[model samples]
Target: MGEEFLVNLKYSPDIPHSVDVIEAGGLTKYYGEFLAVDHISFRVKKGEIFGFLGPNGAGKTTTIRMLTGILKPSEGWVRIFGLDTGKDILRIKEDIGVVPEMANPYIDLTAMQNLFLVGRLYGMRKGEIRERGEELLHLFGIYDKKDKKVRSFSKGLRQRLSLAMALLPDPELLFLDEPTSGLDVMSARLIKRIIRDENKRGKTIFMSTHNMGDANELCNRIAIINHGKIIAIDTPEKIKSMSKGHTVIEVSFEPFKFKPGDFAYGEKIEIAGDKVRIHTRYPDDVIKEIVHYAEKNKLKIVSLTSRTPTLEEAFVHLVGDESE
Candidate 1:
């Protein structure tokens, strides 16, 4: 029999070993007496686009810096592709790419030259660098602007060039921080398409962004952090459902005022504006009660609908703050 047959090749392990492309255990970073990251732990699987979300000063950047080896953690561990980011800095860098919150391409060089320079720094030969540069320029939709000085490029173009530089090494992992920060709608959409295409090619992406919409659209899994602490981490659907189960429906009527205490409101009810939103396992029952009250008092119905939970709603619920 062949070696494959002799080894019980008909059967496979229940779980594959490629689950964790990035693993962190109690990862923490301290600057002086302040804790920037407070012992957060999470795992990202291969080919997964993991979204890291937090408001400004929420330690999102600090966590990314530590994972990319720009800074070391004060406590705990971070492993990328099973290699310690701290101990295997050089090896890890060889297979990872980072797009910082800011794109600072060399202003003195042309767009093409910037990419070529990056390729050389990656130890690629001249011919290889030229080939890769052309490929990347085309990939980023800047091939026509290759000869233009980076200083003259628009912010969107510059961002694309920076991403091209990061992709020069064909890394298995990519780290992007606020990549579409200053992009217009069209540019942002293009970048999103590029990210999607890269992920389709089996690249693992670790992304941090203030754009909740993009995070909801792109992430395979998401983690919400606040004040350096992780509040929730899971598939977007699961995270949203956690809030959905406690969702409230609000019905508003003109010339009728109702106090919450009048009814045995569920624990998840809130009073806002001219409406009283209440949460329950049975929205129909709540609606019936509201209709009964309105009819009893002969109230005029203004608006009546069940409020479904959005990712934004889930964020506000978990973060305990509403977005401006």
Candidate 2:
């Protein structure tokens, strides 16, 4: 069994262990007089998924473009694999796969043809292209539609084909921007699964997304940006811990007859139908008060659950404060 497992394993020999695959220092960007990205410094270790998270127009795309060498940074620098992006763009690009936001495959070509074109652009040989393209199509679950014209495909199919094309060369690092944006449930899940599989194969992934679920599920470390500034950077658990002793308690009653203000123990309370969500720093005290209130009102508690703060909550807490 061990031998069989070893035989089936795939490895990326190019990525050095325990090294920074991407490094940025004081990275900034300006469009004319308006600042698009403020000074941001971060490092992405090899073989980990690093998430860049922010709302729309928060300089996420600008940071990605600069790191990919598509746009010049107005100040500071980024280095990939110890090579400066400005000076070694061609060399750096050879080992990186990029899936930009809303990227589309060639409409006039078939899915296989699109992969073939990408392979050719990377100077892959005929046999190499054929083998890798087919593998990528199968990996992305679009092999059966390989010969179908891209124009006839759905948005999800097009996005999958674009990702397949990006993976044709089996690059060491992948840069994905909102990879699941506008995708349906199944499509989004499939994309996320593929990302996890790629990370297991030792690929370094730098991803930018507004989807908090994706970041919480996949990222080893995340940087939260807002208004051109990165306000927080850490593991999801650590960032969520910034909620600082806050907890959310949700309760459902057999017969609803209470208003949010009637509790008078929570920092914030929200009522929806038969359910109530209470936020508080002292969960035990709040729970005791809730039990006392239920007994006094002769109400039966149907169910109750307590939850820690989520990535979305942490993000909103950080960015919302900045906005205010």
Candidate 3:
């Protein structure tokens, strides 16, 4: 089973273990007088998925742009694959694949044609393009649509095609900006699976996402940026531990009328659809109050569960103060 699984592995023998595939020091970007990215420094190890997360107006986009050479940094420096991102961008481009947040295929072309164009741009041989293109089409579950015009495809399919084009080169490193954003459930799930598989096949991926669950699930390490600065960078567990260390009690009752004041121990209370999400340091006390409230109000507890802090909670804790 292990041998079979390793059959598709493409881990590079050239890059040694623990080597930094990407290094940035004091990377900053400015739009006129407004600072878009402050001095930020970080490293991405080879063969790992590193996540960059932030709110909408945060510096995530600017940082990614600088990393991919879309926008030159106002200050600091970036090195990818041991080559300077600014000075050796053309050379660096050869070993990297980039999928922007709003990646798109040529609307006038078919899916297969789009891949062919990417292959040509990468200077791949015709035979190699055909074989690799077919493989990617099948991998992305868009094989049946290879001949279909991209203009007629749905958003999910277009995103799939964009990803396929990015992967067509089989580059050692991938820069994906919101790779699964606005995608359908199945499409999003499929893309996440592909991310894991690609990492297993020895690809280093730098991805940015607003989805905390995706960051927690997919990232080997995460960097949270706020107000043009990186506030926290660490493994998801370690970062989550940095939160107020509250236990989250998710409970839903029949006809819940309990107000936020009802749970005296709850530090934060939020309404999630029909459920109440309560964060409390004193879980025992909050749980008892929930039971008492249910009993007195003649409410039936539909479900109740408790878990430790999540990345979302940690993220909120870390960036809440900076929110406008």
TM-scores for all predictions: 0.82, 0.90, 0.83
Model 1 per-residue lDDT tens digits across residues 82-130? 7788787787787788998889699889987887777777888888878
Candidate 2 clash figure, as a count: 0
Worst 10 residues of 2 by lDDT: 9-18
Model 2 TM:
0.90
Candidate 2 residues lying further than 4 Å off, grouped into runs, are 1-18, 321-324
Off by over 4 Å in 3: 1-18, 250-266, 269-278, 282-304, 321-324
What TM-score does structure 1 among the candidates reach?
0.82
State which candidate, 1 or 2, has the greater lDDT.
Answer: 2
Candidate lDDT (C-alpha), each:
0.83, 0.87, 0.89
lDDT of 3 by residue, 6-69 (tens): 4433434443233678999999988999998999999998778999999998988788889989
Question: Which model, 2 or 3, shows the larger TM-score?
Answer: 2
lDDT of 2 by residue, 1-324 (tens): 346543433333442333678999999998999999999999998778999999999999999999999999999999998788988898789889999887768899999888888888889998999998888888888899999999999888888988888888888899998899999999999999999999998889999999999999999999999989989999999998787547888998768878757887887788866789887899999899889988999999999999988888778887885555
Work out candidate 1's RMSD over C-alphas: 5.5
- lDDT of candidate 2 at residue 202, scale 0 to 100: 81
